[model samples]
Target: MITVFAEAGYEVDRHFDDGVVMLGFDIDPTRRSQAVMEAREHRAEARSMAELLTPSSVAVIGASREWGTVGHALLEHLIDGGFTGTVYAVNPEAFELHGIISHASLTEVPEQVDLAVIAVPHEQVDAVVDDCARAGVRGLLVATAGYADDGGDGLARQRALVHKARAHGMRVVGPASLGLVNTDPAVRLNASMAPGLPERGALSLFSQSAGLGVLLYASARRRAGSACPR
Candidate 1:
């Protein structure tokens, strides 16, 4: 009997040959077993999310030139953090922002984009998601807050946004998220709107409450500053 299992987007086939279990393909048994364990541990949805967190290139779909907006802050953070990967700023009305070339849409950007950070108004999120999907973006970080957080009609729109992302095989981080940051020096990704960057350390923090997370980062920065010799 041959049994096939799909896990974390990977398909594994096991065959019972003469009372012995064997993998259908010519793969190292040890490696195959490890893969099976990993697959079982993570689901398909989570696998895509993992990719979203470590994208090499990111596009800011609602990037803005205005200083006070979330889109502007996020773009500034990425630049100040020294993110080594490519960054694209998308806005139909803008030609340039902070010296970076701004495209009218995601599709207009010539390079491949791995992730899209949407900071547009809630009403515009769905259309932007559609644009991102058409542009082949695999991950989405929706920083816009008006959706489900607003209740009623907003919830329905949020649902539609998620449905569209899933249909295109893309992973969404949040519709009302504080954003994300990776302290790795090589990656140097800071996708959040936090006041400042926290010092790199062994410990990593994940907070559901955006306010608390911002405060935590601020405290970390203070602690790091305090520890430094004057």
Candidate 2:
């Protein structure tokens, strides 16, 4: 006689004719199976991140009209960088910015937002994240600071923000990041807060320090001289 029990392709227990019973010997297979699942999950997440990086549409939350501000600079960069995708500026106080209509909130936007760039204060990060989750945003780029790097309660806040974003199946880029940029002609997304746009090139850069990255980008632009050879 033989008895077997399985779950989702995993064998839980087995019994054979010689009165032999396998108790928890399935641990190895279970671990291996879990590892496989996790690998697949990581692959899926990588694909999702790629899509997010090249979204067809983006919404900049906490956009502002005031010059020199992070929110304003991000919006300006996106526009000046020649991003072909739809761009939405969200600000409750302003109806328009840089000639584009500004929605009062993410929920108020009529179309779906592929990625949401948040520039609000750290204190308001939670609420904005909640709004983005409710709006079904696929990716988040948080430009606000005052978390983790600030230490103490700030670290907890950053952890909570990540947890909430994960719970809603959304990916977060940063709590105090300089944001990202893509040089693809079809999707020219310059979401960073750099002083100037870097010339388009094949080289993609990732920097650990925001200040250093901006300086490097500026230097590259100077060397490239207005246009980067394709």
Compare the candidates by TM-score and give the number of the best one. Answer: 2
lDDT of 1 by residue, 1-230 (tens): 23443432334667788998876543444555677777766777567656766779989878888989999998889888788798889989999987799999888899889989999998788888888888888989999998878989889988988999989988888888888887667777888886445667765666777778767766666778442111
lDDT of each: 0.79, 0.82
* Displacement of the residue 126 alpha carbon in candidate 1, Å: 0.8
lDDT of 2: 0.82
* Model 1 whole-model lDDT (C-alpha atoms): 0.79
- For candidate 1, the clash count comes to 0
For model 1, how big is the CA root-mean-square deviation?
6.5
Q: Per-residue alpha-carbon lDDT of model 2 for 1-230, expressed as tens digits?
A: 22232432355555465786645435455765676678879999779868777988889998999998889988999888888899999999999998899999999998999999999999788999999989989899999998888989889998999999999999888888898888777888888786445667766666767778767776667778454322
TM-score of each: 0.78, 0.79
Give me candidate 2's TM-score against the actual structure.
0.79
Runs with alpha carbons beyond 4 Å of true place in candidate 1: 1-46, 225-230
